[model samples]
Target: MKRLHYFMIVFLITGISYAQELTITGMVTEDGTGTPLPYVNVTVKRTSNTTNTDFDGNYSIKVNLGDTLSFSYVGYESEEIKVKKNDSVINVTMSIAPGTLEEVVVTAYGARKAKKSLGYVVSAVSSESISMSRSERRKARRASKKSNKSLNKALSGKVAGLTISNGVGYTNSNSSVKIRGANSVSGAQQPLYIIDGIPVNKKDIAKIQHIDPTKISDVKVLKDKKATSLYGFRAIHGCIIITTHKGNYEIKNNESYEEIVENSFEKVRTSPLSTFSIDVDKASYSNVRRMINNGQQIPADAVKIEEMINYFEYDYKQPKGDHPFAIHTEYGKTPWNKETQLVKIGLKGKEIPQDEIPASNLVFLLDVSGSMDQANKLPLLKRAFKLLVNQLREKDKVSIVVYAGAAGMVLKPTSGINKNEINQALDNLDAGGSTAGGAGIELAYKIAQKNFIKNGNNRVILATDGDFNVGMSSDKDMKTLIEEKRKSGVFLTCLGFGMNNYKDSKLETLADKGNGNHAYIDTMQEAQRVLGKEFGGTLYTIAKDVKIQVEFNPAKVQAYRLIGYENRLLADEDFVDDTKDAGELGSGHTVTALYEVIPVGVRSEYINEIPDLKYTNSEINRNFGDELLTVKFRYKRPQESKSIEMIHILKTGENKVSKDFSFAASVAWFGMKIRKSKYINNDQIKDIVTLAEENRAADNQGYRAEFVRLMNSYQTL
Candidate 1:
């Protein structure tokens, strides 16, 4: 019946490529300030389709007349417009409404219902919440990583039940979010994060296109059981419905940026970062003695690099940037949202080209494994990869390779210039049979080698769930094979498809050894993120073998542990060894890491312990203090066989007057509170949210603004 319907629809619509000329344009704003607000929601009356205001406070949607449009945003009144004519531009202002965090959302079968009418309790975290949290952390995650934004040290108690793990350090690769204790144990326990009606898994973190939080306008969370039950087993962990705010304007700079930043305040609710500051010393560490006896070295210098970096205290300014997100919200209520936490969020950050990114010659190797039968898996993969295909340039080229019971090459090398053919190939793929992943891999590499774009980005994109049960299945043996293959001028980027028994352990090694990136494609939007938005970073390689080693002075410090990145951790010597496998980076990408310091002058337990065994060489040079921690990176031009090195010198100082000092720490607290790890005590979620609230950025992306509301809604449960 479905096929018949589709056939009839296709037959009837065959000659209607150019249906009609109709235009819809409008401006969303805060009712109170008469501010042209960005991220106000706008949706098609009878459809799930939606769009948001751009940074310029304008939206242009192309649709036929007679379509009813809905408008909504957190802390603002909602309105609807009827499209009755062509070329109409309607400007609208949305007023702030009390208890606005509560908004309606869609769940399961695309139902619509009011927030006040639902029988079950649900919470909506709009894009606003995501933007707020992203802002506090973006500064630290960017280059130079030198500046303080805002944040409190203790974030555990701030939100009612949100737990914060240890608050010692902050790392980009590590995500602190673990919803309501460890539910999955080994598998992902995080509540599914759905963006634009697409479900995404936690592993998608690495694939995130450095989306400016400022571009996002709002978000809505689904926290109730019945509300999420429609997703079946997957929703047992709960759901977060993210609504991104956008505008359809063409302004990529100042005009839209300033307006969006000002409009963000209409929903701002708390002040935090300025609420308090804590002093730490060796005496503060509870287990300095145990840490020292275990043979850990401490820094002798009074300055703590981790603490200083953790709070964004450096002089480095944000790089040049452009907001790419376009958000739209509808005025009417969604099917769910019994207790929605309507959040408006966005990422407003800078992007700097890594010197110059290499051109790319990519072979998209897909595994049509039978395991990819779920909606969020292979089906979404097709849509997402198409988004990336649309963004390629003439200099880039793409090829398609797939494996099922047998391996085969689906599409030969095609010019990235021809998006139509690329998309056609992607759309034609189907999933069936057991996975013969290895054969497909070899074929992809051979193709990549055959058409190696000299001095450019040459890599194979392997998309799969990492389930390689047939042929070349052993992890140890596979490691050796990848190592041998990596020596070729070709690099690899492993894109994981689907979840449920995802082989993360294998995918991690493959990408790390092949000197590429590991990303999980859980949704079509993420596919756009990994392929289109970050084409340069995802397909090209600028830097490889990136490593960091911090040597603490036992005299000044007693004990310290890394905050996160348990997976990316490397030996101190590995920092300089080019042969050892390490992490790779793309153009215009930023990585951040942080640590907590216990000063020497203060009577802290962390620095009080003495080593049972003396050092072999007690004498040290004067440069020891200058070399607290060394960040060394070795990389070859994407097409080169050997590698070169780049170095950054880091020195720490204590200062209470620095703004850059606290902001990075604010990011750390946000991460800790989200993960609920055991590293932090006496910390609360409320305090962290409060800190983020206070340290809102001059150019907020709706992140901190929304975080305040999510923290508040946690109380309703």
Candidate 2:
């Protein structure tokens, strides 16, 4: 009986010990601020069990009684706490790194690797060091908030070969961050920002201002191919890895994403008279180039061949007459398939010198919502606008309007010469709350109309990620609103900044209906190109409602395919309707289009068979004999309602191809290769690279050379 009692007591003791091995759950945060720190590495000393804090800084792990748990975060002092018998939650507060020690660097895909093991150069700045720097700068500028110091500006002189520029919005959060130099011409040049092992998109990064800088532990910049290769295509732009303080509970605030709606290819025989609005926007081209260079297959919907072709500058003849644009046409054998002939259509808008340009009345409609908290959005936007401000003359005037859950005028009708006031107002702007884009648009138009300059440049430059969730957010609603607003004679220029949950479709619609142009600003260089180099072209509308209608001759062609401009296609009757909305062309803008035509005698698999028409058939028109196609263009003056018409007929001539043609063809071929289009069977990356190299002209600015390098980069991938 005594032996049985001893065994029972031992069994009870073992069961109690087993039950004590429970899990601990809690958050780690800054000691005083209570700000959650993410990416805090939690581990059990001498054990393999480990875990990381989520975005909310929440973490959970299992432990037995008396087990020691260690919490370590870069730039933060390490802490250890013993697990008690009944302890279910143990929160830790980590301070800045104490003394000179080996710093831990987070690399590709959130993998924490020792800085010493990394072969490539990685510039890392500890939060404590930044704090010291900020403290000194704060003493110098006692009037300003220490939190306002932009990440770009904060790290300016700290990193080697890293260039930081101002971003688009109000705060310093959206500042442009670049690593090393530009490797891809068409891809995003800004480095990828990873917060606490989570890859934060440009959109969310804009709102990073909400993240307490004090909660940050360290910022590491990954430069070199090996360091960034793990991120795949996104790493082509390099990467900025940041580990913040830890805490508990996941914060699920950011939920932004995007997908393009693709336009389907059409049959020429069924639709001989192809009509489409002339698209001068080059966003699609740059976007596609980004995808390709990132080692990604370009989304078919994102492949706009017309935009790609129009991206490069062509040696088209300038307009000699009173017309706003000149028409240039050429016929050559298709580079991809020799069996088909390609017809190129080019339109060169009359270039007006800056002195000749009209006085500008500009309103900057900025989105300062929570989404605009990154260093690349609002901050970069502000920098971009500053560049434009520097370009403005005394005659030009500017106003600032912002939206985020509400719309308000920040800077009222300030003259270009009063740059100090404008700069001050820009600096005073802050970001928070939800996006109220529609309300901002309405208010901006009202301001623009109040200060409307007749026959002058009156435009609202909207800078945002187009994350309109709060008010009037639907595409249909936004399109309708823009359509109604365009009647005010105020053109719109939508400058997209940041990525991840970017509403590309919404922005495109706004620009399409608002009688304006759309461009994506991925880097400060792009900002300089859009708002500085092409300032006149970007802001001044040379022609409006521009439409292109091409009538292919059945006698000369069996079947034809329009290379791109699928989204711009219009009804055949819409071409003659002056009331119908089309596309707008800016000063000095160039638009190009290509059509692959199958000769009557050639047999191609792309040609679809159709039953003979019982009532009407596409009969040969002898009057247009030997003429391949007739291209008709109609456009109106910026302020005019009626369109002026122009026409060009492509006739049988020498199949001679110029460097411009070859270069444009090469770009198109590269785009197709990236898209893996149904028609890309004969396409080869090597051939595209060769064509680009052979046709590269005197690249005074090295743009062509950059493009060649990009093509080579794609080939290697």
Query: Considering every candidate listed, which one attains the maximal lDDT?
Result: 2
Deviation in angstroms for 619 in model 1? Answer: 5.8
TM-score of each: 0.55, 0.67
User: Which candidate comes out best when scored by TM-score?
Assistant: 2
Candidate 2 residues lying further than 4 Å off, grouped into runs, are 1-270, 289-298, 715-717
For candidate 2, lDDT tens digit of each residue in 1-717?
999999999999987886577799989997778877765778887664666674456788888877889897755767899988778988888876644322322332566568898786788898876554556555535623433344455567887778766655544345566777535544348677777765765555544433445667888887777754456446677877777767221234332323433334345567778888999887776665545444554456666667777877889888998999999988888888888887889999999999899999999999999788775678778878888988888899999999998999999998899998898888888777789899999999999999999888999999998999777998889999999999999999999886555677888899999999988776565677789989988999899999999988877888777787777889999999999999998889999998878888887887777787888866666887778889999999988898889998988866688889888888888777766777755877778888899998765545566677667767755
Superposition error at 475 for model 2 (Å): 1.3
Residue 496, model 1: Cα distance from true site in angstroms:
4.4
What 10-residue stretch in candidate 1 is worst by lDDT?
254-263
Query: Runs in model 1 with CA error above 4 Å?
Result: 1-18, 21-83, 87-358, 367-375, 465-481, 496-506, 520-533, 553-555, 601-611, 614-649, 652-661, 698-717
